[model samples]
Target: MSNPIMMYTEGLHTIPLEREGIRYFVSSNSENCKNGLKLHVEVQPKDSPSRALPNTQNVVAAEPTSPSGSAHYGHSVILSILLCVIVVLAY
Candidate 1:
């Protein structure tokens, strides 16, 4: 084990991770464990080599979108109003 690496994903994706000479294929839908996010590690025999899948088509990356300013401001206003209401009710 090493220092934890943080990763964020917006949709279904597969991540390839190698640790301690073992290869792991982790899916986004995998379950979490107490030790942190769980990894589905796959160990290959020392006599055999890892194989790569062949791709028949090219892949394109999607463009990232910026957040809207108005949406953020609206959220802040709602949160502030809720906090004020909570304080009033507490008294």
Candidate 2:
């Protein structure tokens, strides 16, 4: 029997399907497994032909105007440092 490639859902899982040619596994019902759910998986064999993504760069929004769009890298760094200081003080 051929071993199927595994993928994780909300937890660790091992698929029993094999990768040969263009194969797809889709599940819309949950009445067979212990997880009470199913997944849709697609597999392409290593030798299968596929389209390649172009190397050209796509335009992205450089200037963020909304609060959700703003990057908060500095805030995360400050929070990390604060946590480290608190941990050290507690020791």
Best candidate (score: lDDT)? 1
* Model 1 per-residue lDDT tens digits across residues 1-91: 3333544557656554433354533334444543366555665544433454455577898988888888779978999999999999999
Count of clashes, each model:
0, 1
Give the deviation of candidate 1 from the true structure as CA RMSD. Answer: 10.3
Model 2 ranges off by over 4 Å: 1-71
Minimum summed lDDT over a 10-residue window in model 2 is located at 24-33
Compared with the true structure, what per-residue lDDT tens digits does model 2 show for residues 1-91?
1244543346544655575544444333334444444444566555423555557587888896676633657788889999999999999
Which window of 10 residues has the lowest lDDT sum in candidate 1?
Answer: 18-27
lDDT of each: 0.60, 0.56
Candidate 1 residue pairs in clash (backbone atoms < 3 Å): none
Q: Model 2 lDDT vs. the true structure?
A: 0.56
